[model samples]
Target: MLAVLIPLVLLMSGLSAGVLLGTQLGGFPLLAALPTDRYVHAHAFFATRYDPFMPICFVGTVVGDIALAVLAPEAAASGFYIVGAVLALATVTISLVKNVPTNKWVQTLDPENLPEGPDYEGKRADWGRWNRNRSYLAVAALVANCAALAALAVLI
Candidate 1:
């Protein structure tokens, strides 16, 4: 029962992380195309939605990994747990430091007052790069989680 539950919880947590990171990354290109007004609104919405999830997911992931590690020591030592934890931490840092601040700046913009220029392009590119980095971390974490689950299954 413990064996089954641990992996299941970790898998779900990993899936949630993947979804959140993937959406943030995948949405960038679409967000880049929006007019200033639309971009501001979308940025506000994303900021509202994105900030809360990282901490929640980070806690869930840490708890899930710890639980799995205790339940399956052999698998834990295989480096999956370590890799996953690092990746999760990276994702949290990227979202909190890089993405959230950019979103806040976007929210401050007055669409009517703001001028179109190279600054917007530069900012968008920076945000896009950071988001892409977050996506990569998320994918790495997911792989580690999956590998751990497989190891747990085999041990069980």
Candidate 2:
């Protein structure tokens, strides 16, 4: 069980990092560079692709961490998994509250409706910062989860 959980947790953490980075950094910049009509269509497509994946990754990290905490109480008693879970929660919260709203706003924009160049650049940059912050949190959680997994590995 411990062996299985460790790899699963790592896999989910890796995927969460990839998806978040791709959607925020990759997709946003790509959309920002395109012309208005293309931007709208691309942004909508990316969001549709992202929304389905994000929740599963987020929940998987949370559940995996919590399960680790429960199964290896001694390891979690040291607070590693707890800290990881907290970081993961922050990642989820920022994604839902900050990033998702920005994506929605971007979806509503038409090329005719937006100012040229720097206007969209500024908007994309603002949301990019949020994405970076979430990335940091996810990385931290990954570290914490890995630490707990390591501790469990040693114990077993």
Q: What does each candidate score in C-alpha RMSD?
A: 2.9, 3.3
The residue-by-residue lDDT of candidate 1 on 2-110, one tens digit each, is: 6575656566566656676666656776788897578777767776774455667676776666665565558553468767777877877887799888888887887
User: TM-scores of all models?
Assistant: 0.80, 0.78
Instruction: Give the per-residue Cα lDDT of candidate 1 at 33.
Output: 87
lDDT of each: 0.72, 0.75
Tens-digit per-residue lDDT, 1-156, candidate 2: 966876887788878877766655576567667875676667666766766677887788888877777777474534787787788889999988987887788777775566456465566677778888998888888888778767766766
Best by TM-score, which number?
Answer: 1
In candidate 2, the residue pairs with backbone N, CA or C atoms under 3 Å apart (3 or more residues apart, or in different chains) clash, namely none
